[model samples]
Target chain A: MPIPDHVLVVDDDPDIRTLVGRLLEKNGFRVSKVADGKGLQQLLEKSQPDLIVLDLMLPDEDGLVLCRNLRSRSNVPVIILSARGEDMDRIIGLEMGADDYLGKPFHPRELLARVKSVLRRARSLPGDVQEQDANATYRFAGWMLDVPTRQLYSPKSKKIFLSGGEFALLRVFLNHPNRVLSRDQLLDFSHGREIEPFDRTIDMQVSRLRRRLGDDPKKPSLIKTVRSSGYVLAVRVDRGGESHGSDDSGPGD
Target chain B: MGVEPDKIVVQIDEDLAEIAPGYLENRRNDLKHLPLALAEGDFYNLRILGHRMKGSGAGYGFDGISEIGRAIEEAAKQENRQGVEQGIADLAAYLDRLEVIYA
Candidate 1:
C-alpha cells in the first residue's frame, strides 16, 4: 500500500485546527496542525510535508508572504484558507503561489477534493502550472521567466520571484498573447480545476498579475482588459531568443 | 476499596470550567474565572473563551453550551455587558443541573 500524504494545517484558531486535523485524518491524510507561521517555519526546518493548508489571517505574519517564500524555495503545494472572500485577499493569496484557495464556512469535502487534485497535479506536469524543466526560460517585456529555477527577473535585471499562480498566468499569456482570453478559459488553462459554483478566483489572480507587472489601472501598458471579453496581453512573447512573428493563436479556437 | 474512617459524606458546589465535561465535576476552570473575567471588563478574554465554546460545545454534544457561547461571542464583540451577564447566567443555570458522582 502507498503511504498516506502528509498535510500541515496552519491556523490561529485552535478549534478550527483541531477540527481540520480530525477531518483530514479521517480522510486518510496524515495531518499536523500549528497555530501560526512561526510554528510552520519550525515544522518545515525539521521535515517537509507533501502539502500545506494555510490560513491567510495569522497572528504574527501574513500567509501570502509565507506562500511566496515557500514557492521560492520548493514546489511543495500550498492551499490557502481565507475567511474573507474579498477579491484582494483571493487575488493576493493565489498570486503568492497557493495551489488552491478555500473560503471559510466551506464543507470539508470541498477542501478534500482540492487537496487531492493539487497533489495529483503535482505528481504530473502536463496541464499543470508547476513544470520543472531546465533551460526552458521565456523572456518578455524585460522580465525573464526561468522555468526550471522558478524565478522571475525584473526589467532592471534584478531577480524578482513569481508565485506559482502568477507564473502560470504569465505562461498562459506568453503562449497566447494579443488575444482576449475569458476568465473560464484562463481557469481551465492554468489551474485545470473546476470553478466551484460561484468562484471568481481567476479575476482576482488577473488583478494580482496586473499589479505585479506594474500594469497601470489608467492607460495600462502590459495587459489590458477588453470591455466584456476578459483580458489581452499586447506585448509580443519572446521564448528567450526568438520572437513569434504572428499571433497564430486565435482569440477563441 | 473501603471508605476512610472518620470521613463524613459531604456535598459542595464550586465554580469551575470544563472541557468536554459530561457533568459538573468535569467542568472547566472557566466556571470560576468567567465571572471575574467579565467583572474586570475583559471582553477580549471573554471573546476568545466564547469562540472556543461556540466551536467545541456542539462537537462535544453540548448544544446548550454552544448557544450560550454564541451569545457570549456576539455580546463580547459589541462589549454588551448585559448580554454577557445573561449568557453567564444561562450557563450557570445549565451547569447547576449537571449531576456529578463524588466518588
Candidate 2:
C-alpha cells in the first residue's frame, strides 16, 4: 500500500489539535499535533511532514512568523487557520507563505478538500526551492540576499527583513531580472496559483516589496512598473555560492 | 422568553467521534466559567473565551454555540453586562438540552 501523507498540525488549543488530528487521521493521513511553535520546531527537526496546518494565533510565536521562518528552509506546503476571518488576515497569511488560508469555524470537510487540493498542487509543481541552488546568495542593485538565512542587507550593510511573500517575490525578480513580469506570471512564479478575481494580492505584495527595497512608489527604480503590463527588476543580478542546503531550520532565520 | 425545546439534538459527523466528547465537556466547563467571569467584570477573559467558542463551535457541528459565542464576544467588547448575561443564559440553556448523535 502507498504510504499515507504525514501532516503536521500546530495549534495552541488542544481541542483544535485533537479535532483536526482525528479528522485527518480518519481521512487516511498520518497526523502529528503540536501546541505551539516550540513543539513545531522540535517536530520539524525529526521529520519533514508532507504538509503543515498552522494556527494563526499560536501562544509562543505567531503563525505568520513561524511560516516566514519555515519558508526560509523548507518547501513543505502550509495551510493557515485563523480566528480573525478578515480579508486582510487571509492576505497576510498568504504573504507569510501559507499555501492556503481557512477561517476558523470552517467545515471540516472544507478543510479536508483544501488539504487534498494543496497536496495535489504541491506534487505537480516543480519544487521551487529544489530548483534553486541551496544556500545560494543573489546580489543586485547594491543589496545582498542570502537564501539560507533569508536575510537582506542594503548598500550600507543595514539589515532589512522581508516576509516570506516579499522574499519570494524578490527572489523571482532576481532570477529573471531586467524582464517585465506580468501580474499573472508573478503570481504563478511566486505564489504558485491564480488568486480569486479582483484580488490585488500580487499588486499589494509588489508594493510592499518595493517599499522594503526603498524604491519610490511613484517612480520605483529597482522594481519599475510597466504601463499596461507588469513590473520589472531593472538591475543586473550576480549569483554566488553552491546548492548546499542549510541545517538551521529553527524559527526566526 | 421564547419557547424552549426539550432537547437540542446535534448531528455531528462520525469522523469527529474521537474528539466530540471532549469538545462538549469543554463547553460545559465554559458554562461554569461564564457566571464567575461576569461576577468579576472580567470581560477580557469573557471575550477571549467567547471568541474561541465562536471560532470552533460550528466546525464541530454546534452552530448554536457559535452564535452564542459571537454574541458574548461582541457584548464583552462593548462592556454590555446585560447582553453578556443574555449570552451566558442562552449558552446555559443550549448546553442544558444539547444531545449529540454521531451520524
Candidate 3:
C-alpha cells in the first residue's frame, strides 16, 4: 500500500488540534499535531511535511510570522486555521504566505476538501525542475513574479512574499489590469464564489493589497479604486514565462 | 438614548457567560498598555490585540464589547490616542452594564 502524504497541524488548542488531526487522519493523510510554533519548527526540522495546517492563535508566536518564516525557507504549502471569522484576518492570513485560510467553526468536510486540494496542487508540480523559458518570469511595476517557485521579487531583486489570497488576487488583477472589476467579478475570479453586495470583505482585501504594494488609497498608483465601484490595476503588466502546472491548479502551489 | 433600565439579559450559553466577565476585564486591562504602544507608533501589536479581542468578544456574544474593540482598532490605526481612550472607556461602561444585566 502506498504511504499516505504527511500533514503537520499546529494549533494551541488541544481540542482543535485533536479534532483537526483526527479529521485529516481519517481522510487518509498521516497527521502530526503540535501545540505551538516552537513544536512545529522542531517537527519541520525532523521531517518535511507535504502540507501544513497552522493555527493563527499559537500561544508562543503569531501564525503569520511562522508562515512567512517557513515560506522564506521552503515552498511547503501552509493552510492557516483562524478563529477570527472577520474578512481582515482572512485577508491578512492570505497576505502572509498561507496557502489557504479556514475560519474556526468551519465544517470538517470543508477543511478536508481544502487540504486535499492543496496537497493535490503541491504534488502536481515536478520538484527541482526550474523552467528557464522566457515565460517563466512575470513582471509588473518593477516586480517579478517567479511562477515555478511561487515567489515575487521587487525591482531590487528583493523577494516580496505573498499570502495565498494576495497571490490569487494579484494573478487576477494581472490577467485583467486596467479593467474596472466589481467586487463580485474579482471574488469570482479569485475564489470562484458569489459574494454578497453588502460585503466589504473585497474592499478590505483590496486595501490590504494596496498597503502591501505601498500604494496610497488616496492616490493609488497601481490599483486604482473607482468611487463606489470596484478596483482597476493601473500599472502595466509584462508577462514573462508561462506558469507551471495547469491553469485549473489550486492556489499556493 | 437610555439603555433599557431593566437588566438587558441575553441567553448566552453557560460557559460563555461564565467566562465573559473575566475575559472582558482582562481585555480592559490590556487596553491600558495599548496607548503606550500607539504612542511609539507600534500599531501592529495594537491591531493584533484589537483583532483578537474583536473576534473573542463577538464569539462570546458580547456585541457591544466587540463593537468597542473594533472602534478602538480603527482609532489606533489612525493614531487617535484620545479616540482609543474614549473607546476603552466606552468598553468599560458596556462591560459594567453587562455585569448589571447578568447579575
Write candidate 2's Cα lDDT for A209-248 as tens digits. Answer: 9999998898777877777778777766777842222221
The fraction of correct interface contacts reproduced by each prediction comes to: 0.03, 0.70, 0.03
lDDT of 2 at A134: 53
Q: The CA-based lDDT of model 2 is what? A: 0.82
**Colliding residue pairs in candidate 3:** A94-A163, A97-A163, A135-A240, A135-A241, A135-A242, A136-A241, A137-A241
By lDDT, highest first, what's the ranking? 2, 1, 3
Docking class for model 3 is incorrect
* lDDT, residue A181, model 2: 68
Compared to the true structure, candidate 1 yields what TM-score? 0.48
Q: Chain B, candidate 2: TM?
A: 0.91
Per-prediction count of colliding residue pairs? 8, 1, 7
Write out the backbone clash pairs for model 2: A134-A243
lDDT of each model, Cα atoms only?
A: 0.70, 0.82, 0.68
> What ranking of all candidate models by DockQ puts the best one first?
2, 1, 3
By the TM-score metric, which is better: model 1 or model 2?
2
Better of 1 and 3 by lDDT: 1
Could you give the candidate ranking by TM-score, starting with the highest? 2, 1, 3
